[model samples]
Target: MSSRLALPPWLRVAAAMFAVGWGANQFAAMLLVYRDEDGFSSEAVTGLFGAYALGLIPALLVFGPISDRVGRRRVMRPVLVLSIAATVVLVVGGHSLAVLLVGRLMAGVASGAAFAPGSAWIKELSADRPGGTGARRAALALSAGFGSGPLVAGAVAQWLPAPTLLPYVPHLVLMALVVPIAWHAPEPAAPAADTSRHGHEVWRVLRGRPFVLGILLTAPWVFGAASTSFATIPTFVDVDVAPVAVTGALCGLTLWTGAFVQPFGKRLGDARLIIAAGLLAATCGLLLGVVVARTDLAWLLPLVAVLLGTAYGLVLVGGLTAIELMAHRDDLATLNAVFYSLTYIGFAAPLLSTLALRAVSPTALMAIGAAVALLTIPAALASRVSPRR
Candidate 1:
């Protein structure tokens, strides 16, 4: 398969993107394992979940401009190596919290470093493809990787032996295969004419109102709501009805829905409206979650997943569109880094929700989430109506 597609640079980059995303989320389903076998507190598990973002944010910030200057492959190669190292850490030392933290952190760094440049690479490689199609493909690859990671890990952990160790083996093998492909693929030339200093240009793009408002009002919730659905909801589901496999399936469903619906979001054209509608859908989903928890109707979990997933798709694509429209060509990677750095904050959703749960019932906590989503709607609408700069 590799031989036949040796010249397809986008394929190699897409595969590596998928692997990075998969590695990032592989630990999601294992949060339960940590709670059950290791007796880690919910807070500890959520912190582990957030650790990825902690490492990811810095890497995104640092790597974006570096890739812009040095070209994508140079940045991607080392990050791919870091990705393999992360998996090895998980395979060998997953039992220890400290080790798990290191692994998650490395996974974050890998993701942060690779995602923007890899995405930009895919876009450049697919320049001959129809408008926006490259972006969709990149998003789909990452989403598939993100959604499938936990599902595979959960199923293996539930039915197969060596739950922790085995789940990572496949990813390690995948990384090994893709690393050579990434190295062999052609590197696109960096922009030749930019005279602006990196930090100044990055800051200039970031200070634009459209980009700032779009990211501030919508980007965080895209993953924040997703983390709640994937990381927190599964743990809350009735174990009898929603075992490890079921939980994993739910997480996958949420992500897959998000992935599939993104193209439609691009077609919607109005970023503000898309953001508003997404927040509304997410609000409904969270409110439904409150009902499901109170009524103990686990069957409705799928409905909640759909709503939240749709919201994720709409908000994500919408925000990306806005950023892409706002950014200068040379500064795209840096802009992506800034945008994604804010988005990664959503990884803390599980931890924040768990913390909220201590002071209020699940129902109340979800209600709070719903209200927050509601509040964002007006801001999104306002942003949409605001004159373009």
Candidate 2:
């Protein structure tokens, strides 16, 4: 590998963002292990899954504006440290449910603190790059990290020894090295101005029809559909059709597709159209999820991944692009944070799916989700009519 010093500032920041995202989703594959080994109930596992959002949302609301006031580096450095701490907590605590909860909360805080600032830093560092390139790079880094975490964890947990301990060890090592690299990454000379506004300002911006509707129609479904496709659907599949390793790979496939497709979203040249198309893809994919679950055609999981991944890519990039166009430079981080905060709602999909299963069959639940996705199309289409700020 090349020396850390030789890597560009944008790459370093991207690496840090990648680490944050990886940490956020690393536990997805581990949920099954906990259930089997520790005798955890399905509800307990669901709680653990949702715990990341518990820590992430508040952190984003608070740290985003702080990063806007202070430079990005100052905010990112401590969050990177917190990320390392979270991994250590996970490694040391082993299968203890309380410890895992705390570790996940810390992981959420680190991700929330890092993502918006790190993304804003990438944009500033790549100031000379073409339009939407920075956002594309940021999304790719995050998707790769998020997708790979579960894949690596599942593979190691299944084939390798020390299921819990070993999976996090590599992340610990990577984060430790990334700390210094992230510390050295360059910051913009001047931070954004008007950083002292109250929370009302953020709310005021959210009131905009374009920003609110764009997020409403796209952001939550991106991860919600992903959770359905990757996390929930795999668990229910027959072991013969979807082995443990194969499940992880499918999760990775979904995310990697999202990461790779983002650049083409830039090429598509219309954020509104991308959002509309993404919602349509998601609707079809959710309906297919019902079919995949009912028919036991695990072979079709890849097709499901493609649909969900394409939705993830187009909606995420298009939504971010729309938000960027509407936000003031001074409020960019806060706006990004706000957008992401809503996005985290999708992370609750696994938990919600679990509960919904009590009342309705998986097929019925997926059909309902597909209907919800379909209903959002009008909002996505409406986004085009509003002029970009």
Best by TM-score: 2
Task: Note the residue pairs that clash in candidate 1.
Answer: none
Candidate 2 regions off by >4 Å?
195-201, 385-389
Clashing pairs in 2: none
Worst 10 residues of 2 by lDDT: 380-389
Model 1, 191-232: lDDT tens per residue? 583755655765765675665566776789878878878776
| Candidate 2 lDDT, 1-389, residue by residue in tens | 35878998899999999988888888877877788778999888878888899999899888987888887888998998899899889888777999989999999999999888877788778778876667777888889998988888878878888887888877777787777777788876874386466456667767777776777657998788777777787655676632656767878888888888888887778788878888888999988889987998877788898899888878888877776666666677888888788888898998988988999998898899989999999888776534334
Estimate the TM-score of every prediction: 0.93, 0.95
Query: Candidate 1: deviation at residue 61, Å?
Result: 0.2
Q: TM-score of model 1 relative to the true fold?
A: 0.93
